[model samples]
Target: MRKLIFALAPVIAMGGITLAVAQNATTATREVYVKARPTDVLSSNLIGLNVHNNAKENVGEIKDLIVSSSGQLSGFIVSVGGFLGIGERYVVVAPSALKVTYSENDKKWSATMDTTKDALKAAPEFKYEGRWSK
Candidate 1:
């Protein structure tokens, strides 16, 4: 009886360990935060974003990202048109249209529509009106 009990003890311990590991694996994933500088964060992965207007014309490139006081990504400030920044227009794009992706080869972000520069320029600029769009 003693020998049999000793043999069973190891098996029982292994079973309990397996059960604990399985339970942990099923738990929901948690978000992790990493420390980064403000200037570095904005400059990273934002410089080459291709900007298109409502008419689907490629307007320009992303100049910088604007963050709100609450530490949330507000919008993208893009430089459009003009030679040597003479006639360039800085437009703020909503975050909804932006898409960030990473593939085997190229890693970049883009807007999902063939929006034209003129249309983007004409779209209702972001405002702080109390009512939200329906």
Candidate 2:
């Protein structure tokens, strides 16, 4: 009926306006083009990389990376004291604690930490439960 159409007109117009605004906002914020710089290392490359201490002793391996809601690197999850996925403990290390480097000639990437294997094992463990569980 005409009365019904009149009642819904404002709502429909508001929806259309809201949709247009959302589209424009998305376009403005979205990255349409991106390039990988030489200094940047992919997360896929870092994950599973073995971490060693200053003396080159095996400490742990990077299992996962924690990212904040604001798209910031929060922590690196390292698995320590594990043999073939058996008795490993997971610990969240600070982003600055692990040093990552790339070698062009060797075509390899390496990660190093200042702590030892026993130190990492003694640190607080992070269980992949609750929100972190698959």
Candidate 3:
């Protein structure tokens, strides 16, 4: 009984130490916000951005980013052209398609797409007077 009590004492002490340590641990909650500088933000580097069409071709590059009145990025204004920027038409792309990535080899930013250029051009152009969401 004495030997058993000695062994159990150390085990009980260890359990107490563990409980004390656990009680002493502190927990914190933090909030983080990620914002990009207007100058640092570029239309060319957005990821998963694409111009898609029912015919499956990418038409052109995104010309500008549109934001909400509350300052959140809403969509992309894409410019599609066949003979350079001269004949381009503008379209809006959903923000879901855009992602951001870094490239070590090129040492520059690039945008990737799940859709082709031809497909993008095939999509309907945004009418100047109408909301893109429509």
Top candidate by TM-score: 2
Give per-residue CA lDDT, model 3, range 58-125, as digits (tens): 54566666655434455667776656556777767766663334457977544444655655668778
Ranking by lDDT: 2, 3, 1
List per-prediction Cα lDDT, in the order shown.
0.47, 0.70, 0.47
Worst 10 residues of 3 by lDDT: 12-21
How much does candidate 1 score in TM-score? Answer: 0.50
Query: What stretches of model 1 exceed 4 Å from their correct place?
Result: 1-42, 52-57, 107-114, 123-134
- Model 2 TM-score relative to the real fold: 0.78
TM-score winner, 1 or 2: 2
For model 3, the superposed segments whose C-alpha errors exceed 4 Å read: 1-59, 127-134
Clashing pairs in 1: 53-115, 53-116, 53-117, 54-115, 54-116, 55-116, 56-114, 56-115, 56-116
Better of 2 and 3 by lDDT: 2
Q: Write down the worst ten-residue block by lDDT for model 1.
A: 12-21
Q: Rank the candidates by TM-score, best first.
A: 2, 1, 3
Question: How does residue 42 of candidate 2 score in lDDT?
Answer: 67
TM of each candidate vs. truth:
0.50, 0.78, 0.49
